[model samples]
Target: MTRPSNDSLNAAWDLIDHSQLILVVMHTNPDGDALGSGIALTLGLRQQGKEAHLVCPQPTPLIYEFLNPGDIVEPEAPAGVPDLAVVVDCDRADRVGALQGLVNQARRVLVVDHHPPTSDFGDVRLSHDGYAATAEVVHYLLAHRSVPVTGRMAEALMTGLITDTGGFRFSNTRPETLEMAASLARAGASVADISRRVYDSRTLAGLKLLARALASLQSSPAGTVAWARLSADDFAETGAAPEDTEGFVNVVHSLRGADVAALLREEQPGVVRISLRSRGAAVVSQAAEALGGGGHALAAACVLEASLDDAEERLLQELRKWTAF
Candidate 1:
């Protein structure tokens, strides 16, 4: 909400304006907001006659393929080292995976994010948790500069807004959020099309994985903390990847009397990835931060180096400490 400061925010714009070559990146395993904002920014920059490329640690997830061009995002940076790099929807450079080296090599870096702060890395950090998603920040900046919101940019930014706000159903959806959405809709972003593609287009493998995740659901004695687990075997058997597990934790959060929900997936024998979501006064990010992850107050994530059993107990303890319920 404090913005990257007025001066810092302007400096970010100045930096982008002056730079000729730019690289845009998001966190590893990016969600809709990260991907959407990244695409919109890259396209906007290119429209202004600057050279911009988007480099992600992983390939685009299947569900989001519709919003991306075939060659828009790549796993590797271009041969030429960019003069400026803009980190979108992410606060830490390390979260961009092996590409952090390339980011460091850039003459300057600007971080545009909507998460609570974790570490400071970029020269200009536009960290605003007040906005519902990073895409909103991009849209506002574009508007401030009087940049035309093309249909492509509108659709991409709309994807960011709708997905991160859980289709405008989450607590983060402010009046401004709805206004931005309405504006994008006016600019030719189709709400019905985006909803169907993002929320209702899961693959058959993903559906099987969701079923397994539901079957593994468990809860605390008071049912205030609900959780589910998935082994590597579950993914293999279901032919689903980590991306398929997206939003599964939210399903656990829907449990009656649950203030906090978690989904723990064993990526391998000893490592487990966890997602946490909360309702009411629970600040799940505090627990996630303690677990070496970071996100918003209502939603967060972390990874565990311990066995699945130990990881579950550790996450439960942290969630219990943070949740009033």
Candidate 2:
């Protein structure tokens, strides 16, 4: 909960300006927020006369492609790594997958994130839980340095801010959040268009994934937690890509009497991915970090080295102990 000092911001600005090449990385299986923030920062860094590129461990989310500049992310680092590496929207280096070495190889690593961190991975970290999305933090960084916004930057940043904030419906939506969104809109970001692309468009495979998840929904006796699971075989059955289940967990959370909702997915043979959402500040990141994962307080996630069934059992055990308080 420490406020970032002026010295840290100034140091980040200096590093960003002096670096010849800057490489930006986001977490694996990126969502709208991750893509939006990374692309906006890419634009911001380029505008400052620095060469910037985006690298992710996996392919860009289909929903995000429309908002971002076409094919902005390079799945592999081209040629050599950059002089400076920056991670956006993610807290830990492990989440960057193969890109972790790129971060370690960099002379300077600047992390701009909003997620609650279990480790101090950044040489200069500007983290604020008050912000709804990482794009909001990037917006502040641009404003602090008096950087002008282009329509591309505005569109990207606005997509992140609106989607992560649930169209400003979540409780984290504050006056400053709205102010940031208004600024992006004034700079030529279209709210209606962003909504249409992000929410209105969905593939048949995605709907099948949703149906499978909903069929697996189970609730606790106290109605405190509602959970669903999707195994690897289910993905094969539905022909659903990982990105198809982007916000499927939120559907379980929307149920009546549910204070918390969780989704467990089997990414591969042995990797199980879990997403947790709480109606209040239950601090799921602590639990996630304990299981070698990390995220925000209200919405945290972890990947367990176990089957989806085993991971669910372990996660529910932790939740039972936490809710006991």
Candidate 3:
């Protein structure tokens, strides 16, 4: 993994130190990485006596209720404009959703992300795709600036590392990743507790949603591609929120002969959300970008303005262009 340059790290520190009220923003529909990194940074800044706030465009998912760092409010135009806005775990400005306008109002923007940037917007961009999670990058940044990593910060950072690596099972798991996990563990992060809460804990509604998604699973003729669809009715019948679909795509991605997996869900009446996953060889981000979405190479997502069936067909065609099957 490429290391963050000292120049960028120093610049980020200068920006943070000079700023009194800092606003930390994460992407909409935040996953573990986005929430973890954002919360960790906010807490760290507050510990340093800075007025830092973490804001999201959507509510935090129930699954992450355990790592509550307090006061993660929904995005709004602040009463006093912040000196610096730090956007975390988002590849593009649009990913910030409604928060983009508020972020733009800041005097300066600093983007802290692990995904490759889709556009240039931030005044100080500290992004490197080599890191497995944005939390890892944030950890490095804090360490470089000599900020103490508190137990709570360690737990939040560990959550990002564990969730993004799929419990250290994904190909992104490197020696440095494990070493960082070990450091967080030494700093009071509980691996067993985190894994249990994140991966094992699921509500009945979530299980029902997963069952429905698996029941609708299909595959290509050559068995190289596996796909599934869940309509809005499935969400209504199961009483599951959109966040309940988290990690559901992994089920199809684990198929024996499947090199690529796609999950199409009707997030709203006329809006379909498509998630794509691969076994590392296939660059699924290309397909996601083609559909006006963006993410990592192995895991990506896109939302389409079409019915579930139409979105599935369109995604399958895009997947075919990238995968052999």
Candidate 4:
């Protein structure tokens, strides 16, 4: 695995040493990479006798409740202003949602992420898109600092690695990723248990939601683009929260002729969440960036402030502009 630069690693450690109270914030929706990095950092800092608090804009997804990191709190600012804020797995500060205010209160901001930065907000930005997951970067940082990776920390980091790589099946997975997984396993991370809880176990309601989403699947005329929609009604009927629809977008990529896939979810009345995926050289991040969202080349997302139908039409227009087929 490529190592983090010594300058960046030393600078981050210096900031941590000079700070007493630290705030760690993840993105609004709080995916596995986001949670894994934030929680692991929180635990690591606290282990060093520093006061570290983890903030998530939304509640932890039911599937990830196995993490049970007690330090996670709502977006509200803590008792005292934090000396340092660590933003993980988020490309932009605004992605922290309401917690941006709390982060702004910190004296210094350190951004450790794997996505391309949309803006220069953090005081110290340690971003490397080459890494498969932000947790890998975090693991590197901790290892360099000589922080012992506890069993819990290993599990959390492994969760981020597995989830971000689609269980090591995505194109981003590399030899280094597997190497990290093997090290984490040796440190007592249960690959089987974490995989089962994250990918295998699903609530009955989630399954119903998945069925409804699949039922709405559609393809473009040339069959190069496949898409699906999940309406607010579907969520209400199935009694599934938005988090339960995590991997539903991958279903579109299963189609034989599909080079691009999208999943549009209408979680609120005038708001649509768009998740895009592409194969080979097709770049879905470009489409997401056009819509004021960003992610990796193959997987990206955006939010549209329109009705589901209008969002669908707009996204289709955008996808057609880049899709080869």
Candidate 5:
């Protein structure tokens, strides 16, 4: 979809105004960008005299505990249907989990996301691969409509911007992204606090989980493609949650000669989840799409029909083709 314009911004605002209760949902196993953008948008909508609440499938990362002061509700919902629902950072309705029913049952829907989507599930869609984060798109949208940004809102937006852009290390980070970060910082976002909370608060289980992933790492074809497979038993042994496995693929991508990385996680007995990362001269999303998934050029993911070992081998074969070395 196209980037939302000023006129489109007004249309979104108009939609918000007419809707009585706006239900906001984000992707499952949400990262900082997903949680931050959804929460910030919820806060922004409430400040604008609208009734807004956040619902997600899984609990947010423990690092984000500093953001809010309550339990993440896994609501036994379907309380009628919402007047309007906004999906942020979710590419597909299935990513919304139990709320998928609510999205289907809602009267109107809008999807505002940064990822290249696999599904066109929104009545009004605003998707831009150019933006570094969905927080960036939503920030500009709110700023265009003269929506006031509180101190808390600034903090949330900054968290999304920093985390998704790899603290500005990722290739997607642009000059405008930095400028937006500066603006958010100036508007009362604390870089030190966000950094400390997100990066420095690793749990003991997370550390052990990282150790297991590192131990399982493998390289192929002169180390152009690196990979690791994590099983449910590994998580049980390490006492780590699923979110702890996040970014383990990046460890492989960081290898000196490795241009691409894959993490094949056995989420269930027969279900394998594939997460792909690429640095340069490789298009990970293409491989993901070939497996019925989609995301950005640098990072993408897919669910494999095969078992763990088979999925890992299949992904390794695909990654081998992308490597020049």
Candidate 6:
């Protein structure tokens, strides 16, 4: 990943300066980074008297309900075409899901993300490669534009920072990332509160789902690779929503001597979603891309319209290419 070019950065602000009504959107799953960056940017734009609205096709995950990403992320797209639409977190516009229709009608589109830019989606891209999270890039852009950071904005940005960095425990967490987090804390984001809700909080349904996932865990012959599966039945039986499966992959990754891990869930009757994690020689993003998905090097995801066994096999095959031992 590379940093945003000065030309693209200038074009992004120029597009904003020339527009009035702006539509903000994130990827379909609406993770902490998506919700936080979208909310913070929406709030900041509104503070400057722009008619900015952040909307998503999917509801905010239960774990991120504290940020109230749903408060402004209505399902209804704006009736008319927006002067500019900003896509956050995701590199491609298609990842916006049902909201793609709304983005298609916008006069201009700007992307704010940290993913490896694989597609030409936005008219002006502020995608940076080195940041720990998209929220970090958003913060840098906001400061570059001289926007005043509000308490609410700070809170949302912190959510993105903490969650994506795993509370600053991941390899991507740098000194500068911590400094930005401190700045956000000074603006009002509570580290303890965000951590408690995101990492510590658990629902009965989620716990039940975790048990089923653990029961289904499997490993490769070498024991360096691990995976888990949950069918639609498991989710329905446990009364667990899709978002409840969020961190379950980490449990698989924690398996002793595992270099790579995956969690596959049947999102629908034939549609399976897989999340990948790696901490060794594997770069899961390549596997994700081959499976028609994309993400960071350590974390990536993909979707497959196949049976649980088939999807599991596909992912295992991908992992086998990297984790031979």
Give lDDT tens digits, candidate 4, residues 93-197: 888888888889999999999986678889888888889999999998898888999998898999999899989998888788899999999999988999999
Compared with the true structure, what per-residue lDDT tens digits does model 1 show for residues 18-80? Answer: 898899989888889999999999989988888999987577888899986465887778888
| lDDT digits (tens) for residues 1-325 of candidate 5 | 3346877777777788889788888877778888788878888888788778787756567888877725333344436568889999977778877778788887899888887767788877777778889998889878876788888888889999988887788998888888888988998999888988887777789889888888898888677778888887888888887777766787777888888888888887778899988886789998888787778899889998787888877777676666653
lDDT of each: 0.87, 0.83, 0.88, 0.88, 0.80, 0.87
Q: What's model 3's TM-score?
A: 0.96
RMSD of each: 1.7, 2.2, 1.4, 1.6, 2.3, 1.8
What is candidate 4's local distance difference test score? 0.88
For model 2, the local distance difference test gives 0.83
Of 1 and 4, the candidate ahead on TM-score is 4
lDDT of 6 by residue, 1-325 (tens): 3345567768888999999999999998788998999999998888778999998766677788888765767777767779999999987878888889899999999999988778878888887667888898888778877899988889899999998988888888878789999999999989999999998887899899999999998888898888899999999999998888878998898899888889999999899999988884788898998898878889999999999989988887777776674
How many residue-pair clashes does candidate 1 contain? 0
Q: Which prediction has more favorable TM-score, 1 or 2?
A: 1
TM-score per candidate: 0.95, 0.92, 0.96, 0.95, 0.91, 0.94
Query: Candidate 3, residues 1-325: lDDT per residue as tens digits?
Result: 4668999999999999899989999888888888889888998998889998888756678888888844655455457999999999987887888888888889999999989767887989899888899998899899897788889889999999999999999988878889989999999999899999898988899899999999999998889889989999999999998888888899898899898898999999889999999897689999999999888898898999998878888898888889888
Among all windows of 10 consecutive residues in model 6, the one with the lowest summed lDDT is 1-10
* Per-residue lDDT of model 2, residues 1-325, tens digit only: 3335677678889889879789999887777888899998888888889888888757667788786445578777766758899898877778787888888988899999887666798888888777788888888888778889998889999999888987778887878888888989999999999988888777898898899999999998887789999999999999999888877888989989777788999999789999988778366766676777767777888889997778988998888865532
Rank by TM-score (best first): 3, 4, 1, 6, 2, 5
lDDT of 3 at 238: 95
TM-score of 2: 0.92
How far does residue 200 in candidate 6 sit from its true spot (Å)? 1.8
